[model samples]
Target: MSSTTMEASAALDGFHPITRQWFTEAFPEPTRAQTLAWPAIAAGRSTLLLAPTGSGKTLAAFLVAIDRIMFGLPEPTLSENKPGVRVLYISPLKALGVDVERNLRAPLAGVRAVAQREGVPFHEPQVGVRSGDTPAAERTRLNRQPPEILITTPESLYLILTSRSRDILRDVDTVIVDEIHSLVATKRGTHLFLSLERLERLRREDDPQRRPLQRIGLSATQRPLDEVARLLGGAEADANPEQPVRPRPVEIVEAGRSKQIAVTIEVPVEDMTQLAQPVVTGSAAGAPQPASIWPAIHPRLVELIRGHRSTMIFVNSRRLAERLAAAINELAEEELALAHHGSIAKDTRLVIEDRLKLGQLPAIVATSSMELGIDMGAVDLVVQIEAPPSIASGLQR
Candidate 1:
């Protein structure tokens, strides 16, 4: 660790005891990425953090933001009726938004406890998610009573900006673009640039007295930092004459441990007789070869699960996730394990996540649904059944 890391670690140590306790309870220690990124983040400087998944970048970004909101310089008093969004957290996927909300509850609860003990007027910062799945009534309520922090997807953010709820963004003090690298090379990011420009214009128009909203971008992996910075800083023509055109500073923190990828390449025997046995009988007789060719794959999967106390098996698709999980359950019969994927309902996902965190689940066979920053217990090892298409996806796993 360098001097900067030491200072940051100390700063993190100085966080309200309850908040620190909450962090430890949730995740025992900060990842190397968190240690390197927190100081700049806590200073209110716009930053782009690049670190692999399972490295705690999500909590690092929000922890600093929440600390600033709760303990940084106080804001000037405004009317209670002046309803506006203070923090805008945008993700590319609605599922990511749901995961973010669940992850944030721990720190939010800690903040509330601190306020209560200190005798400060505790206003629990309201956080709500808006996406295609959000109900009409909830959307209407969000417009009428915007939360202090709004967690949403890029498309949903664009929709909110263009809709009647545009005023909700007028007072946004910080905008966090999560999974930014996921959008950078695509048309969606190009479109999002326009939205961000619109947001800056809105902030200037609505609250001319305050400074522009701070912009922070978070990603798992980014190469050629300068190019990533330029993409995030908006096109050259948009640079303002009055304000210095400084690209947001980006910090890349590699994981403490090198990439943990356990790959197993198995060539199936040419015999179609023994390998053709059905692992589960609920489905059609010849339904697309049961995804994983379970009879050949199950034994290896069972071996991996039995060997490791905690393991995550990333299958090719959701259908495979369910199929492999069913087969594993049948094989083990008594071990605590489950199938996890997007097809499962939100409530079920939360339950599985909780069980994983509690160390009650020995292993979970999942798809990309488990790839995001959900607190799914401690994974001792990750088994990639097939090679991920890109370095980004592989790093995330």
Candidate 2:
């Protein structure tokens, strides 16, 4: 092998043979983010990884944790004494959390397949999700026999810490917070930080000598990296009375530069004033209703959907999403689109997401609910009906 090839392979040396084999076969090579992050994470550093969407940033954060659970442990199988949760993944959005849970299945199964083929013992780690959407029975089951990895949201984590579920988190050594940018600037961010501090106290109360939690934060869009780093690494007071408190140490990995975006602006009417023209109909004589701009917009959306393999339409509200989706399907003369927003049932939204991923649906009209890091497989076109809520929100789309 060439020197460069040898160097790249060295990065995977810390992982188990089964993990390394499965990864090599699954992906051509480690992404830039993964190459830079695995070493720091394996060395047990709290790290904040910045990378663009679809750059394998999620796998960079997850693969090592999975390896540790499978191979680094003294026993391959979970014993009665070692059954507590070991890794905690926190996502800001419920859809993103659910997407992550579905995505993890591939890697877990890949590694397990490698082990079985080689006649090696494989310990399949269980994963559990706890959120408002989780059924009561499922929550009780999770509490009784906690999974090795727990995926949750900020509010759910706070609730877990406050209730009896907190016990399941006592042995958690690693916390992976996805989409860190969304949570660093608002009251929600403040609440999550407070919860992190509380979790630290809970861990220490369980075992005072245990090492501090290892936090790994992932974000595709952020500014003034230092500020986000400071938040990721919470504050600690110095021993000296006069000195100000300092933030904990956190390693920053920069890779995956944002792709240059192309924009096009189109309008249905030649003159802006034409949009306000009143609709005249034979049956409606009581009042003159302004004409709808949607009639003009729906056809263009259908045309775009036909042109692209997959398209995502972002609107400002749920009502618009539903209307736009139905209009597009009617205009296309087929069920070519689906609406995804907070108001939709969780199971229904999941089915829509699956259909889009499988290329069964050509388009999905969504609101801020799809603005986070949910993986939309093969979606190459994004149409924004109105301006996004903010610049960060737009970038997420």
Candidate 3:
């Protein structure tokens, strides 16, 4: 009824009927990011959506791609009318890719339900995850029957681009990069940018008339967004030989920039300078000093865990994660918390993640592995053992 409500409703006009119905039924209204992002993406433009966490930025990038796959027409070049992947989702973390794949099931199923109820045609979208953790057999199956939406990490995407698997990506029209800040300054980011260029080349070779890939980048914290926008859109070859290449056009959507963050710094120890035990009589000068603060820290951690529904404790290394979890269990006399890090087996890590999401686990001692945009459900409390490696890392946790 209001003007803002009217604009939000108008943004959904470009989506498929089933998608719109399912979305309207599932959510009361779209987030600010979604309201601005859908229109640009629906218009086949590259988009960089900057918004705070929990602002539905992921869904803002995903829903438009899902709608296109469900109702859009297949490329004329398909040999036997078999559709290959059309949406490529790149995440810096494998866990985040897997999480996105899992999260997509609800929306896909919801849209399918809407179509079935209305007795209309519906193409069930298939989503797949390809990462180092993917088994050989699973990878083979994915190649044999490519999903409409493919989720992968930058490293995995590079591998796919180099190998024969790249053929399956010739029809991809959309690329969604998650956590753009993590990759913008790293070798991995450069590798991913080169891989995207490779992907563009592959698509052009397949069909010279096809349009350039539509890029969508999602990030919560990124400074000098102009620089990131150039990376997302890359560059385009200019028609005139006298001129240098120009940056591709991209739409920027910044929404929900102001968010409420409650931070409390708690020190359990009474004395600041006496945080460590007195120097041992026979210890060497550089010997590992025992942290007396931890003795007081453990009980406080337990009390906080018991008070909160779910908690994530982040440390800098895997060793610290193990030590913290062991200490917490030793004090609690139960397996109230588990350690999660890269060193842990993939199956075990997934079990821990699932447990935390289902409210079966009260706390997790994790390294940077858990700091990304993995949807940890109902995480009301987060404890960082020390200052994070960077501001971006701290914000991610």
Candidate 4:
């Protein structure tokens, strides 16, 4: 034990008593990202949290919003959610949005239950998800009784912001952008920022008393982070030609250096040439994998899967994802693993995602599609056929 450990309980005093208790129970102590993120976000500052995977950045943003919605909103008299959305969470992937909703249930249920037992008046916040996969009837339900927390992909959000249903977002006060790095590197990200800007404008114009949207961006990997921070929510910096360019008023919590990755190399059997041939060593590396070594590899993969609760096998292409998944399941008594790529039907993909998260599936062989921040519970191991395109990507996986 250290001085920091000794005083951990006192540090959470600023949070609502129920939230503080839940925080202490769920997380033994605050993660570094949490320590930095909560204070800034609690103070209503736009924040960019750059931490590696499993650092709890999503919860850092979410918990603050949850606290506000439950107890910290500007309106002291209001206990329940307002007419429109209160917190809108945007992700690049529909699957990621669904994944976040699953993770939120634990905290929502726990915190609300604790609040109730403590004789605290509690207003259970409703959470709804909208994406391309959402059925028309479900979409209508969300509009009729909008949830306080809405999880959505960029495209779905854009549609919501632009549609007649835009009024549903008029009260949105907090917007969390997860996997911010994935969006900022492309034109799609540009479109997302525009949507965010539009949503902000709606909040501002809808009511003069409405609080400014508190934006929080979470990323596993980012470079030129200041630019991303500005895009996350910061207004353009002042045009003081004489002074050095100052970053906008966004609090950046970067703990990328603190993460440590221990990588282990495991070969099924020592000499691969005995099992397959020279092709395993050369010529078929990044392109098409050699058919020869797959037979030996699949059984080892099945063995590895049997040893783990859940596994995520990342391959270079969808074709390879299908082949590898089929190969691995062929060795099993029944289909224990499934292939997931962009080409899969949206409903099917959601089912596979749910099954994987619920521990119903042994493993999923996926392409880069699964690489984004979808909370598929815990994966015992990740198998990569080739090194990811970049260090950032590899870290995210």
Which model scores highest in TM-score?
3
Model 2 stretches with alpha carbons more than 4 Å out: 1-7, 74-82, 238-243, 258-260, 276-291
Error of 2 at 49 (Å): 0.7
- Compared with the true structure, the alpha-carbon lDDT of candidate 2 equals 0.87
* Candidate 3 lDDT tens digits, 300-385: 99999999999999999999899999999999998889999887888899999999999999999998888878897689999999
Lowest lDDT block of 10, candidate 2? 73-82
Order candidates by TM-score, high to low. 3, 2, 4, 1
Shift in Å, residue 26, candidate 3: 1.7
TM-score of each: 0.76, 0.91, 0.93, 0.82
Point out where model 1 deviates above 4 Å: 1-6, 9-35, 52-55, 71-79, 120-123, 207-210, 235-294, 330-339, 359-363
Q: Alpha carbon lDDT of residue 54, candidate 2? A: 85
- Cα displacement (angstroms), candidate 3, residue 248, comes to 0.7
Each prediction's whole-model lDDT (CA): 0.72, 0.87, 0.88, 0.81
| Candidates 2 and 3, the one with greater TM-score | 3
- Count backbone clashes in candidate 2: 0
Model 3's number of clashes is 0
Over the stretch 126-222, how does candidate 1's per-residue lDDT look in tens digits?
8889987789999999988888789988788889888878887877877888878767888998888779878877777746555655667777675
Per-residue lDDT of 1-397 in model 4, one digit per residue for the tens?
7776644444466588899888888777987777767778888888999887777888888988888778664442223453678889988887788778988999899899889889898677899999888899999999988888999989999898889899888777788998998889789999998888787677667365555678889998888888998888644333587766543477788867564556777675567666443234456555544446566678888988999999998888889999988888778867878999878988899899888888899899998789987776568788877677767677778
After superposition on all C-alphas, the RMSD of every candidate to the true structure, in Å, is 5.6, 2.9, 2.4, 5.5
TM-score of 3: 0.93
